[model samples]
Target: MSRRILRGFSRDEFVSCRERAGFPSRADLARAADISVGAVYAWETGSATPQVDTLLKVAAVMGVSISDLVVVAENDRHLGDLRVFAGLTQPQLAKAVGMSTTALGALERAEVARLRPDVAAKLAEALDRTVGEIEAAYERTRKRPPGVAS
Candidate 1:
């Protein structure tokens, strides 16, 4: 059987999602997303990206549409706005969602590659957000240039 590799979320999109969720510190988001701190740092810094499954899990946790979290374009600016509206720190958010600071950090950085469905659901509840909202955010941010995938 041939295994196919799935694409991950972009750094900007990851940061945007976190910001939208109220600027939760990397640790807090990682805990909420049930990922590693390294992963979150990687995602936020644009050093790496999360797998599709992981993105979905993150979206659920942030209570936004997956699309909102995945889409990465120069035009998209609502992510930053969302962060201010939510007004949350990474560590605080992670604690609320029952995750370690390290784990939350990974989520913020987009280091996580995948996540279980249950974890995603828990994150959503903790953040007082919805899966659909997360998914939508992902979609909005995923819009690439006419000729580029990234």
Candidate 2:
């Protein structure tokens, strides 16, 4: 799949965001995120990747949107990126939108270029994003150039 395995996580941005959020050190940030210092170190050094739920908590503790800690601009983020940032698994988001997991996965992978407006609406509501944002993200994912990260 062409999906971005790391979802654009930026170690520098994460460290900067933590500092900006008033966490002076990795230990402080780790305490706030309820994770270990080693985990924070791993993230900072790009040696580990955060799961969706863990990233969500870190984002919350840092007082920054997930996009702020990622290389991708918020508007440039694709369907899967948005979904992952929103901490929803394909199965969970699929059930919430009344679609099969396989279908949702296809959409997330940008294999399905067009999504129904009703399904988009459901996604918007479920992901706590605007419908316009949903549609734009879908378009970006579908039209992303070959070998380009989404």
Candidate 3:
């Protein structure tokens, strides 16, 4: 069987998440994710993307989700704004979702490339809002026309 290599990672999302999380450097994030510094660099540069398992680990360590690291849509809520409205800080809200402060910050800023449904559940629970509300916030931020694929 021939294995095809594909590269479609979101560099901005990776960097934004790392920087927001205060990893200090790419090496620090790599160490935390138990991956090589080169791998981190590769993802950030869009040279390569991690497989699902690795991506999950990366998300766990970064306190984000696969969607946050890879998905791209225009209409997203300032996750931080929701937290603020609910009277919480990044660390506080992150704890509610078992995520990192940086991850929360990235979500709030919409710096993440995508927002997955599962992650939305966590955010919804943490923010004391319904999942539909959260979804609506993201939906409002989308730049798509009706029924268009984002």
Candidate 4:
């Protein structure tokens, strides 16, 4: 049998989470992720999807598993949410995980296809979360179902 593609979250959920967390603007997320405010809008409005590398960086900042941002069944994922939960600035998270801000941004944006094992391990340690959690969250986002695609 073929595995069904799971859907993710909706844009409203992303916005709601941010608002509830007291981060009411894309600029806030941009600052945290070290990305342009336009990029934050794109991610929030479904204009663009972040690269995997960028996704991880965002996750680190938000203090969540990449899966937490994913709206499974809706196909919507919010790396920004993860970043907010992690509560780390891009530079701080990058330093903790032993990567340059540029490299971290690449990961958060999913521009890089895969993370080096060592780096991933270090990220897991610094985030005070397990490597398995990070990997599992990444795995859940492999397929984009309808309604959640960016």
Task: Go through the candidates in order and give each one's C-alpha lDDT.
Answer: 0.55, 0.83, 0.66, 0.56
- Candidate 4's TM-score reads 0.43
TM-score of 3: 0.44
Q: Per-residue alpha-carbon lDDT of model 4 for 19-77, expressed as tens digits? A: 66566788887788797888668778887665545655765566655566655432233
Instruction: Arrange candidates by TM-score, descending.
Output: 2, 3, 4, 1
Q: How many clashing pairs does model 2 include?
A: 0
Per-prediction TM-score, please?
0.43, 0.76, 0.44, 0.43
Which has the greatest lDDT?
2
Candidate 2 ranges with C-alpha deviation above 4 Å: 1-4, 85-87
Q: Which stretches of candidate 3 lie over 4 Å from their true place?
A: 1-8, 72-150
lDDT per residue for candidate 3 within 36-127, as digits (tens), equals 99998887777776654566677778887656765534244334435544545456677989887777656654557777889899989888
Which has the greatest TM-score? 2
lDDT of 4: 0.56
Worst 10 residues of 3 by lDDT: 1-10
Q: Which candidate model has the greater lDDT, 2 or 3?
A: 2
Candidate 2, residues 42-115, lDDT tens digits: the string is 98998987766677788999888877776677778898887887776677788999998888878876787588
Greater lDDT among 1 and 4 belongs to 4
